[model samples]
Target: MRRIRIKLNRIPSLPERRRVGRKIMADLGIKLQMGWNPFTENIAPKAYALMFETLDKFLAVKTKDNRPDTVRGYTSYVKLFKKWLLEHGFDETSYVCSFTESDAIDFMDDRDLAVSARTFNNSILFFRVLFNWMIERKYIKDNPFMAVKRKPKRLTQKIRRLFTPEEFNELIIWLEANNVPYLVMALMCYCCFIRPKELSMLRCRDIDLDNQLIRISASIAKNEKDYTRTIPDSMMKYVRKLDLSNPGHYLFGDHPMYDFSPGTKKASSRRFASYWSYVVRPALGFPKELQFYSLKDTGITNMVNSGVPLTSVQQQADHSSLAITSIYIGKTDRASEALKAVDIID
Candidate 1:
């Protein structure tokens, strides 16, 4: 029997106790045991420690079992969701019981500011995922999201704003003068339809300059699948101009890029996104409807306008399904007025 006495004189708070218990469980061979009261007895201590250790185990399993970047995203979103839940009077154990569709909708309604349906839907998805995880472990009886109705049309609407050629030129020039590595990263989003998370893990070894292709390993992609995408030839010259002397180096190394928050090892997509929200985007005098992802939309639009087939563009964009590719092409078609059509209109 291992017995070490800790004095009640310096007893920590509940959260701190949980932390210390987790550390003890991790460092030593001790396990948590909980009976009643939750503040006394070996059973309660062991159970308390087990709960936290299980969360840690779930976290580790997620790290190795899922894509690295996805794990990071889940951790961030889950942590935020947990904080939001606690603030709203929903305890951790409450998640183990399936939440009603109304419960979720009510939660969204409680937000003082009106959030876009997509944004609100995303939060619902986080809870749905959490509950699904709970169900898988027999923590919950069933999934509640299965019954939630689809969000309204107003909330589901997408704002499609392709950058005008003039705006695109000005945006590029501004970034170049202002020194933002995000400029090149943004160009990659346009040129290749590469997601921001994919770009974050890009390494020197993935580029094949001779073939003008970038191999996005399944390891870093959102879809848990590997794909090789062709880079737009228009971007080739500048890509060649980039310093690739250090093989296997990050394309965007730590530099004096515009408003780069220092000490972050990799450029966070969220932080890069803030640049659009605050700086380079505002300088161009674009409206709120115009978005950063619209660069990818612009690329697709450019392809269709240049007479590239939808199927061909789909392959280049590395979309898994034809339906998704069709949506991209269709959305771009709506902006055809923004592009010049040489079809000889009378």
Candidate 2:
């Protein structure tokens, strides 16, 4: 075996040295002509390194811009992709540039079997962003994900089970008896038609008690649109009773079970969901699917059943269209009775 030696006049920077080494290896036929380097075969492929480096930069920018959810979501998708690759016998040294449309399809197919349609769609979206970024940086000649098509999402009719007035009253009693710190949050969701995540983002300043209104900033809103909703008279009573010494404090400030640092303005929805799953649900005997979101459904349905106009319900629910709000208004025995009453004999 003959070892080829090359001497340079001066040492270059680490990045420059890597480039020089790759070129030298290529000239000697010791490396592949592809984007990957066989000389660094023990280490991960250059494509993987570039992909991860770009991901790191992307996540840093997103975090600095106060988009923590985006950071978390992108990180999750990359991790899932890496895991899928490893499961299919591709290790760390596998060339990410070798990723093809078929590879992406296989990953999606595998994911579809294990997760929901919405989750699979989210995974595809993440890949689209990642590969597009890679293409922009010349990490790859083309975006492989662009060639992959998402599976058609099944049109499953959403059946939102709303809490009856009796059930809601019983839940309130249970919450009070248990001294649940999330009682205010539950009340806001049920009365104001606020999503759990939106409720968690509320601060004292966002609430105008005198005017009986709550403002949801664009950053916190799901649609990224700033909107204000009038507080229900019942909810206003609870707001008045709350301690508002600090106008900047979180509306539902941290509890032992679900809390952030004193200076933190918002709580994590995952933490809130954990509290609901482990503590609240078991105590109330609620089913697994009857989550915190059910409160919002219960509130909107209650209003519509009580004869609130469809347009009013749409505004209250922050739905973009009345068609969306109509889904929440489920049929009731009272509705059946009304139909019977309106029926005329021939």
Candidate 3:
């Protein structure tokens, strides 16, 4: 028998190689389905049709658990990631299971370069939750995002400054004079230590003016924990005077001044921010770093300075820990005065 020798020329092109590899893999998969265990091969892992499918399921579960804000955040982050993946040559058919730690790291690094530290850290956290969900459901063997770390935020003594009594009065006067619908919200935040979003989402029935208490429902609370806040005397009369013909109506529903339609629709965080940017900020003479959130800090800080125990102030603010409440206190003259009262030589 004569043995024929074959001569090898140039190797196949990259695309040709890929096509050949895919054909081989497909044949292997078909054979495995037929129970032909060649070389005792491991079964191929199932992959999602698209990244969005996994995201949709994750969001559904989060929503069912009453974590709307978390759902919104995760959705936004995943959408951004999807867009980034597409821009970088990934397509809808790409398996989410194929995503690697390097991919997550690259995404985080790119985002960190383009955004603030807080935003960058938020993206990291979002991906951590996302991949953990994938792993829990056996969609992936491991979380690729586990390797990513959050960027530490710089500690600022005054992250947001507490409003002085004069500044608070000026704000109230401006809101009243301009007929801004957020006047009630501002007062609620300043006096009752209610978060803007919680106050905005309050219903007529949420308030018990007779008892001088406002109940923040778990659905609207930031921490998803319901708590009652005592309504300050200054805001009691105002709360009682609100039109409660519809018990289900939003306490701070739409207003013509704020360009919102009057209805049961809850006031959005965006609308509140817009109101601050265009109206409140300018009206307050553009006070340095002053924001609507300052109302909560101002209220809590005032309580602390007015001889209210830190524990009491923490409870009123609904803070999970005293450490969180301390951040709002900043450096008050009252604290200095109290410290000055210590006579070492007396």
Return the top candidate by lDDT.
3
Question: Relative to the unseen true structure, what is the C-alpha lDDT of residue 292 in candidate 3, on a scale of 0 to 100?
Answer: 85
Q: What does candidate 3 score on TM?
A: 0.78
TM-score of each model, paired residue for residue: 0.68, 0.75, 0.78
Model 2, residue 230: distance off in Å is 1.5
lDDT of 1 by residue, 43-148 (tens): 2122222232345456777888776666877787667655666776665433232245565566556542456777767756765776566556654455556565
Q: Which candidate number maximizes TM-score?
A: 3
Which portions of model 2 show Cα errors greater than 4 Å?
Answer: 1-49, 57-66, 83-96, 135-143, 146-152, 155-160, 257-266, 330-335
lDDT of each prediction vs. the true structure? 0.65, 0.69, 0.71
Clashes of each: 11, 0, 0
- Model 2: lowest-lDDT 10 consecutive positions: 42-51
Supply candidate 2's per-residue lDDT for 172. Answer: 84
Candidate 3 stretches greater than 4 Å from native = 1-44, 47-52, 155-159, 223-226, 259-263, 321-330, 333-335
If ranked by TM-score, best first, what sequence of candidates would result? 3, 2, 1
lDDT of 3 at 165: 74
> CA shift at 260, candidate 3, in angstroms?
7.3
